[model samples]
Target: MVVTDENPSAAPVTVPVAPKRRLPGWARSVLWAVGVVAVLSTASYLTGVNTLTSTNTAQIALRLALPILLAGLGGLWSERSGVINIGLEGMMILGTWGAAWGAYHGGVWAGLGAAIVFGALGGLLHAVATVTFNVNHIVSGVAINLLGLGVAKYLSTLIFQPLSGNPRQSPPVPTFDTYSATFLSDWLSGLEQQQRVGISDAAGLLNGLVTGVAPLTMIAILLVPLSYLVLWKTRFGLRLRSCGENPVAAESLGISVYRYKYVAVLISGGLAGMGGAALVLLAGGGGYLENQTNNRGYIGLAAMIFGNWRPGGLLGGAALFGYADGLRLSGGGKAVLALMYGLVLLLVVIVVVQLIRRQWLAAALGVLGAGVLYWIYWANDDLPSDLTPYTAHFVTLIVLAAASQRLRPPRADGARYQSGQR
Candidate 1:
């Protein structure tokens, strides 16, 4: 019940209570995703809010969610190894520069490789600072963020300015190719066009996921289960997580805590760097724009928290944030307002549950919230553009506030450790 406390970059610290599941973890994750899609399909069918399961929304969500998902996985690796990586944003910045420069000189694959290397280097620096020097993890991470941004800017001025006539941007670079599952897409598209309630909605949603999928997106998606297998099912993962739980115990068991920490943090940086690559290569008509990461690193950290620090959970979290973002970008305020209707229905459910539990005050608040949101949905044709842009952040804050209490992080996460100190 007790673990050493260290610098907390975000407020996530509650451990998760495992529930009964006959299926394997990965299988359960798939079921959960299917269930979510089913619910969304049904919701869209009933509410007549087409954006809920629209192909455009789904496609945009996948693209936007990739970076967040990658960043979250990066957080997972670092935290699971008893280190905290608050410098994910900075790492991503270095990645963008690396990807752009590499793509300019070589190709997309080359850019990916360069991004990973750049990101790993950043992780190595963090390892030296926190693991070796015992520097405060938060301070080290902040410094890295500042340094990364400055370095990227300087590099852009020197390199990209001459080529692109801009100091803060990189020239157009080759992006990863996208492929569609035409085999299924054709059938699904036919079903979707029929507009037949659940059948049509499900088809629409599925079609989005199957079409226009980029290679990096597929790789990033695969990493979710791969992370689960590596971290939850492997001996190396056990030892790495042990460092997070209790390094002293791990050391007594002949685990090299420092080596594992270094490795984990490095992998963390690599994944985050991949996120940066996603932003640069697949983020639509741009190559390493200034501040393109746009605080997604922090949001990804929030997603890790929301997911209770599990790969499947974080994937869901990232998708939720990405959906909100994509809805705003693609559907604009009309879509967001329609989305609010879904939220209102959700609150209505909460109100009923709280009422059943005899939680009078909570039920009342839920009612109030539900009523206000419903009124907004009823009155407004679209959300204000200013507020629409903040949809993802609002979702992040709401999710964290709601889910934070249920989260349980590793016991010794972020703690300063020394060999033979126990």
Candidate 2:
């Protein structure tokens, strides 16, 4: 019969305190590094010292960046699933050979399919070694790389031997005539035809931009968003991430960690294979070579770390590295290019180490160092040819540095399901 009236003016009911904003440390570092790179790269263009004109630079960056981005995405999946894939280069090489062989014999579609199959197989081998056999991830990865390279080289030699006579160079993959025309015209329009365009020298600039937009380059772009969706939105992705983060924990939850790890690694391989196929079909004219993948695999691994294992971030990192690669290939100060790559790798290492050690200052300094090096490279016009060997060697160093960070399996990755564990 009696209802006691609660105080009408009680302090506005506050729900239990909201959690404080906490940005991920890795994310912060990525942002900072990316920002610094963007500013420096932009400045280089404005100064006209790097020779990578604004439009051409972007095109080169995109063309170079795509394969690496794809590879990085693949690496993200495998590593996230708790399997380290050191053989990404090998997978790419194998894929390149397969694609080249298929295209030479069967056409473009066949080459692509073959590359994908080989890549998947590479992934399978990696999975078996690290997941099923519990092999040391690093050693297993190295073995895969060696195996892939040997197999590819042996097959190529067998097919194309007799040194001077029947060198196995496949015909350039056939393109729709209209496709080439349209692209060439657009490129010309962008450079020479524009009244506002500078008059100093337009021929070289036009050539560079046009060449950069290979058909495969477009495919790489499509893969970026697709990979993001696959990694974050699907059931399979959840399982893969779980396995990578804590295989044992995932196993306890009744999730088959081994199965997921196997699948993830294979998928990663498949993508890398696609990357190879793209190179051969789009860049290499359906032809196989001794080191056909051109170290793109290693570059991809670095991009993966530079991107911090996220698809978008990976894409950005890939573009940066790819631009640098393009510069090297296009006769843009090779020594400086080498130094740029080295500095980038060093920056990545420092950031990763700092994260591991919780040393923010070191990470900051590392990034600053990278920016300064890039500036110096941008400023230098006459690079030494003798340093070419050294620069070439740095490619391996870059890959190794990136792989080292990923060598140790993540704590929760590759977990296998056991009874009563879920």
Which one wins on TM-score? 1
Candidate 2: tens digits of C-alpha lDDT, residues 1-422? 23333776555554566689988856975776555444444444344444443445545555556667777877888888877778898888888888877776787778888989998898899888887777877788789889999888777777755432444444345421113346664666555434332431243344544554655666677787787787789987787787778666777777887788788899999999987876777642446667766778877887777666777767667766765665555545643454364456557766888879987876887777677767766666666666543443354465455445544435654333333444
Tens digits of per-residue lDDT, candidate 1, 4-113, equal 44856555567667877688867987876676666666667666678888888889999999999999999999999989899999999899889898888898988988
TM per prediction: 0.90, 0.72
Q: Candidate 2: list runs displaced more than 4 Å.
A: 1-42, 54-57, 162-215, 334-381, 388-410, 413-422
Off by over 4 Å in 1: 1-35, 42-48, 283-286, 354-365
Model 2: weakest 10-residue lDDT segment is: 171-180
